[model samples]
Target: MRQSFGERFDVPDGYLNTASIGIPSASAGEAVAAAVAGWRSGAGRAGEYDEYVERARAGFAALVGLGADRVATGPAVSALVGLVAAALPAGARVLVAGGEFTSVTWPFAAQADRGVTVTEVDLAQVGPRAAEFDLVAVSVVQSADGRLVDLDGLRAARGSGTRVLLDATQSLGWLDADLSWADAVVAAGYKWLLSPRGVAWMAVGPELAATPVAAGWFAGADRWAQIYGLPMTLAPDARRLDTSPAWYCHVGAAVALPWLAGLDRSAVHTHCVGLADSFRAGLGMEPAGSAIVSVTRDGAGERLAAAGVVSAARAGAARLAFHLYNTEADVARALDALTP
Candidate 1:
């Protein structure tokens, strides 16, 4: 409908080059391009590192519904996880939703050294049974099925003392989320956020500001200012959790959010839904989710990969992920490519 805008985004003429990953945009490119020039000219944001950090903080706050200062920028989500895990008391029993991306689990697993107890939700008994754990965590969206989980409903299930954390990497840019109940949240810039894959995570409640177990030079009064010895007073906010965030990364992420926000997010959601729905209708393949779609076909994973149909093998099914710019025709092309 808005060809002028669509042309600027460079939506593909065919099936999206994005599947099982995020689609980068012009704003992202421009940010990195500036970084290159800044680096070569030695004119980077040396004095404005904190300013960039503030920019990142504001976006994180706006996107996830947290205070700007409460957002912390790390190198990636993994780094953010490490900071969270480091801050938590030892022997905390962590309850996570049944299926989570690797970033959520691996860090907790490593924390076994700290006597952390990690448990996956028994989706079979997922009601009040989950109430037993001290900490509860879930992705905003299902990584496998790609279903958007009702975060508010789940967080409300826990007592006030029971902390809730959200992994928002999958749906940050395109989907509207209710983050009121979360104690902390984490995301990356790679996919939907459309920025350099700089890491960022934030805790909403003041309780989490008590500990930022991992500290780095960038976490200081002067961003580039070096520090020795242990971390001092827990940053009154999420800044404590961030060790290092690329200044240019802030510029890129800032540039991307407006464009993403300007697009009809509801329309983006609808188009993705319709495309997944149509893939099912045309191919007679009942696929799943807005982010990832799956059509069952035995031994077809290898075959499809060979045919340049970028996808993944999931729970005895083939999962195809689509994005904002993907057209129905692209779905048809993929369906055609997969046809026997």
Candidate 2:
């Protein structure tokens, strides 16, 4: 039999399915369900809806150990990243890891076209190149093998002038990863945070909030109303970075953050590690410490997909991501489904 391993959180029945991509959910997602229902109907922008959206920003900030004012909501992770690129200077030397998820990689390419000098490097070697780049963007966990990068070291290496954008989609809820060093972080509510797919958030530090490049209409403080087709004075925090209304998505993302806050992150981390370990032990796969286990083989993605199991490819390996909602039995079931 070929080797197999899985995280208990990797189980697919959860709201956020890591089977498709990124981190598995760590909480329930009732808020999003309500938000979407409201959007679908003509409910459109109600006061309660807007309040929940703001609450979601606070909830997201709470999870990352930041002030609520520092968090901003987006339509999706991709849109949040676009805002980041738009905010940075056109000539900024943006550094990204080679072989990152395309969502991250393509943004830089577009940034390059707009004038940012984009450099893709092996992040293991980022410490050396950090001083030269104006900004360093990285996925908290490598999307392929779920390799956890030393974010603290990376931040220090960037020196005081550089901005660090960390994508926590793969590692946010479970891992004991410290995000205090980051200037900005964008993550999807679906992955790891247990919300649905429509929500994503970006949190910015105090310094960046004061002077953002992509200043949006939704960023103003107080009860903002149109004053002759112009934006009112902006808010003091990260909300200023948000350009449009993502009211519905906010409801779900907000609920997910606090719900995850109830569970023990340390326990979830241990559970994920243990489940990954169990899969390796039973399947004889080489043990990789990530919440994900991946391997290289011909037609690997196709093979797994055909078996009713979904996995993503990175370079030569196929990755199976896991998280808090996954159970031991899930690994077994997926393995059975994948039987060749």
Candidate 3:
């Protein structure tokens, strides 16, 4: 119902593909520009860099309902997935949904060197067999289609010792998720978060003690202590598992979160889903759980783009993802473009 959310971005007519890469809000772009200017002028301080990192962590924590200490940063979702793989014991049986994004699947599969075996199962079957595996990893939403995984069922089926990891790339900003259901959550920020590329975050449950597979200087209790060749202690919390973040991403995400915090998240989600519903209805399709709507038509991507409607083609379907910036007018435009 709010018109102001769409004012934050300057997008093309019928631009609805937020699932692939979000158009950063105007404020986010300004923040990155300011950071670059500060660096160019030599006005940046070492302490300010740390402040940006902390600010990003706090921002993500607020979004996910987790303590700031529980959140950590990585260059990408794949890096965070690798860290989760490293924390598992060798020969651990890891269950994942077949045909998932490569970032989520390959990390655990690479653990084969550690005697770990990655088993791919249908998404529907993951919940029932979750107890049998040492770890169960899945996406909150499917990428190719907009199908949502059943989180409650998965949680109920989890055994006491079974660790659950979730790749929230497609769900975090648009859907309400209880991170408590998973031992660790990882997501790429360039999607629904409307952040710059190279920014992503991971949150670890307090009860889980995870070790990073590739620990860097940033993962230490005292980052600079080892410069003098002194004994070093790993950070006592989730910070210990952090990989070095892209500096610009920290600055941009830190600045953008405040603007995002100002908007009504629930309202924004409703607006997006409404747009998707309108599109599907106009296309003569059924309603879906999330903001992604797909139409299986040949050359669908080319047809849509020719009409000034932007979208992504995946698995032979033309996918359109609605974000807060999208309006009913945008959905109508896409539908008109798709009509033969």
Instruction: Give me the candidate number with maximum lDDT.
Output: 3
User: Pick by TM-score: which candidate is best?
Assistant: 3
Better of 1 and 3 by lDDT: 3
Off by over 4 Å in 3: 1-3, 224-226
**How much does each candidate deviate from the true structure in C-alpha RMSD?**
3.4, 5.0, 2.1
Assess candidate 1 and give its TM-score to the true structure: 0.83
Tell how far residue 252 is off in model 2, in angstroms. Answer: 1.5
Model 1 Cα shift for residue 249 (angstroms): 2.9
Q: What shift in Å separates residue 16 of candidate 2 from its native position after superposition? A: 10
User: Per-residue lDDT of 1-340 in model 2, one digit per residue for the tens?
Assistant: 1111211232343212363543323233344555566678867565566776766777777778888777877767667777777767778887888888777767667766668888888868665677688878888887777777767667786466777888887787777667866888888876667666677888877554224455555666653563246545777667766766556556656666765665676787888877766665555676666787775656656666665655676668777766666667756655654444
For residues 1-340, could you state the per-residue lDDT of candidate 1 as single tens digits? 2132352354444433243455556656666688779889988756665665576567667776656777777777766776666666889888776767778767777888989988886434333545676666667766665666655455665554677677787777656556745777887777767676665555556665334566666666554444566545445455656675677777777666556656666677677667777777677755444656666776656666665666666667777666776666667777776676
**C-alpha TM-scores of all predictions:** 0.83, 0.82, 0.94
Runs in model 1 lying further than 4 Å from the true structure: 1-7, 10-20, 122-128, 150-152, 221-235, 262-264, 285-289, 302-308, 313-317
Q: What number of backbone clashes does candidate 3 have, counting pairs of residues 3 or more apart or in separate chains?
A: 0
